[model samples]
Target: MTSRSHSLRDAIEEQIAVGELRPGQHLDETELATRFGVSRTPIREALIQLASMGLVVIRPRRGAVVAEIAPQQLVEMFEVMAELEAMCGRLAARRMFTEEHAQLQAAHDACREAREAVDSDEYYYRNEAFHEQIYAGSHNAFLAEQARNLHRRLRPYRRLQLRVRDRVATSFSEHQEIVDAIVAGDGERTAALLRDHIMIQGQRFADLIASLAHLSNKAA
Candidate 1:
């Protein structure tokens, strides 16, 4: 896609992630075109890309809107995502090359800077890169692809969770331990840490739901 399309996609994705655009809110292409001072073609392209990422839904008669996933279904997706990430960590611990290890460390360092800045949005993007390094280190193409696909689907919810109080700091701390485990070639430990890092349960789940409800209320 063109740079304009990518820019529009990221802008809309951020709005949805931060709850500025609530679930099921209509995403009219014409309005988006006017709002962004772009042509409808770019707006439509951006919406289509977002739809592929599970952040938007395109309907036959209704055009497009923000995707609305049921709470229970969201939980289920997180559960699977956690497992996929854990597996990636496990394999990465044993399989990563020396160069891959260095790259992972660099990604983690970037995340640390984001955390120190206390910018949740920056940290979220850095954190994604850190996890993706592990996925690449897994040395299993199919597994890596599956993890990436699910990760994209869960992007909005995952990004939303980081906005919770001190979540970015906590996430960085977790990443520290995860990196240590993988570097030490402790597959099981890495797996466990990754699972805990990605899993949304207990209070984390509650925080996510409350945030979503707040956004829905605001939209209403």
Candidate 2:
């Protein structure tokens, strides 16, 4: 992507994050171009990127709109994602090579840097790389592929999880535990930690649902 498209993409994502562009809200290329002082071409490219990330839905005739997921469906997807990630952690603990372990540590360090900077958006991107390292470390091609597919589908919702109050710090601490377990070659401990790490629980789940509801209402 060109610099224009990259900037436009970040602009649009920020708009969505701030509820300026709400779920199910139609995106007009011409209007976005006008608002951003860019042409339709870059706007279109940015929208495509958003669609690929599951942030927006692109229809044949209806154009692009912010993607919407029912709360129950969102929970279900997260549950599945949790299981997939747990599996990756388990396999990674058993199968990761020396070089892969080093890479995973590097990703974790990058996440720590993002956390130190208190940049949730930066942490969000780095968190993805951190998980990708786990998937690759799993050393199971089919499992990694399946995990990646679900991971992509849950990308937007996962990103929203970070928006919860103080979630970044808590998540980083959990990541540290997970990394320690993996490095210690404790497959069971790693799997259990990872399962809890990604699985939204009592209050967190409630907060996530409320946040999603707020976004949906604002969009409506």
Candidate 3:
């Protein structure tokens, strides 16, 4: 995340955000270098970092391509994300300290500010902070690390859904439910709600994919 790498990342993420570098599209270093007004070194490094976040795949023969996120992968990730977050909530309920609880409250306040501003993207980022706060509050270093890795992997999809059909407001509501459960130390409710919140996205994605498959078959 140095100055140069940050610039490259911004350029790359812009392409992704605008749908220029779409799913399964190859990332040509020469073309990317030309686009970002830099050489191959920074582009390569940026691609590697993005790949680590599950955004791209760097292969030998074809180089990097935007990762093809399958419906099954989405469903699988939703399952894993639910379990990890639930684990965090359960542990946090049992182990959260005063300072950690205060941090969690601060993060929720950030989410509230984003909601008031009606900035969904900002809401999404701050929502991540809120979840990370709970994870760290769990006091299980290993579980926190695992949840973080999964969270990063799901970032792109999560952001995409945030812009879909008033999902931002819906997400805020879910966060409120989670916070209540955490404060009450209601482990069972926390786990179930987290699972439902995550699995709902998977169900939506499945329906979307199903419609696409039908349309493709009809066109064929």
Cα lDDT for residue 217, model 1? 78
Best by lDDT: 1
Per-residue accuracy of model 2 over 1-220 as CA lDDT, tens digit each: 8899989988898677655777778999999999989899999999999888787899998899988877777778888888999999999999998888899999999999999999988899899999999999998999999888777666666777888889999999999999989989999999999999988778988988877787767656
Cand. 1 TM to true fold = 0.89
Tens-digit per-residue lDDT, 64-90, candidate 3: 998777777777887899899888888
- For each candidate, give its TM-score against the true structure: 0.89, 0.77, 0.81
Off by over 4 Å in 1: 1-11
Each candidate: what lDDT?
A: 0.91, 0.87, 0.78
Judged by whole-model lDDT over C-alpha atoms, candidate 1 comes out at 0.91
Between candidates 1 and 2, name the one with more favorable TM-score: 1
| Decoy 2 TM-score against native | 0.77
Candidate order by lDDT, decreasing, is: 1, 2, 3
- Among the numbered candidates, top TM-score falls to 1
Pairs clashing in candidate 2?
none
In model 1, what lDDT does residue 142 have? Answer: 99
Candidate 3 weakest lDDT stretch, 10 residues: 211-220
Better of 2 and 3 by lDDT: 2
